[model samples]
Target: MTTKLPAAVRDRALQIAHHEMGHYVMARALGFVTGGVTLTVTMDLRHQGGACITLVRPISSIEAMKEHLEARMMVLLAGAMAQTFPSKPSAAKRVDKPKATAILKGEQGAEQDYAKIRELQHLLRNIAYPDTDPVSCERIAAQLKAMTDRVWDRTQKIVEDQAEAIAELAGALVDGMVIVEQWGRAADTYEVMYTGPMLERLRAVQAIPSLCVWTDSCGDAVQHWK
Candidate 1:
């Protein structure tokens, strides 16, 4: 009564699901609230990509802003880092930093994430040094590279430590998508899969309180865990 998806189609969808779950898991683990996660599948079912809706609170102080930016950088980097894991949990047990970094660097899916990271770094530099005069492009490039390296190392560590949780979440995502056709939107051009089950799994994994409330403000999601 139903057509079976081709192996390539299913594998592409699975990869997108894993990538989005990576972001969602890291956001919740870092005490950020997510509106939801989405997996978009074309009608032809050949191309797929996903998005994770992460929310942050507004910050008033420079110190708060710096911390917020750094945390967000970690969240952005987490998606690519998580994608480095083997689809099989058994093979994923080993944490290979070089492999993970290589994947992060080479992943075209992560280009936008890396762009956002650079944008945040620029904001961080300007806000932290508002009075400083403009430096040569070379110096600025070097400084940003140093900042990226520092944050990348930190994000890598977090991803490594959370490998078990990430694997669990990614596995759930791949399993959940088998019924994705049931959730296709009226638009028909693209299908958006629901993330309620994924969120529940994340909350359970992190033992986060069920006191979540929806708001554009950041206090509850950022401070409640602290």
Candidate 2:
């Protein structure tokens, strides 16, 4: 059997969702509104790895710039922490050991049927090592705690109000679209289009995987190869 993930994972895409959502909500709580919650969307129904919510921090007055670089970095790394978080909300159960075993054993069961064949293109490939190991999830969470706590009520309210629309937007983005702010303060408003290189070589790795890599690697996987 391919790794089924937990059936519960289907409920929220993946465990890290709340973490990604936390950044989205907390950014607003911090009042950095260069643009209100910007990024593309996804609806593929796969776990989207962990970056389900793509939140761009607002750029305060450019003339007299004050940078929350640290804050934003913390926010950027928050979802991964959330995904690996051991809390009740994030970790539903222990690792799917049985499925993980099958995956390692070459079972290629139904659960992994789709992923196995798809990953064939990447056989023997090694993902880039994370620069920061021994990283603390709580440290990341601590940086975000203030914003999340500050805007907890408001953010959760926004989530509840727009849950359906958000889901649809994610689906639309997966189909082919970019979710940029129309102007400003247009909550969840997005314009779909096709632009950019549509295929740009990564600075890290010059090889670009066409449209397939475009979606899968967040356009960054090829950076090392470049």
The candidate that wins on lDDT is: 1
| Model 1 alpha-carbon miss at residue 53, Å | 3.2
What are the per-residue Cα lDDT tens digits for candidate 2 across 1-226? 2123234433333233433333443333333332222232233332322222233544465311222332343333322222232334332322233443343344422233224422421221111113323366665445445433432233233334333333332332233323344555553322232122221121211121111101222245332111
What CA root-mean-square deviation does each model show from the true structure? 6.4, 19.0
| Per-prediction TM-score | 0.72, 0.27
Per-candidate Cα lDDT values, in order, are 0.62, 0.31
Backbone clash count, each prediction separately: 1, 15
Range of the 10 consecutive residues with the lowest summed lDDT in candidate 1: 208-217
lDDT (Cα, tens digit) per residue for candidate 1, span 1-226: 1234356555565556666766776676666767556665554664455555556577787676777787788778777777766665577444455755655565445677777877899987777667656856777777778877877776666667667776766555455543343455543333345555546656445563222111233554353221
- After superposition, candidate 1 runs with Cα above 4 Å error: 1-6, 41-45, 93-107, 179-192, 201-204, 208-226
Q: How many backbone clashes does candidate 1 have?
A: 1
Error of 1 at 4 (Å): 6.8
TM-score of 2: 0.27
Query: What's model 1's lDDT at 120?
Result: 93
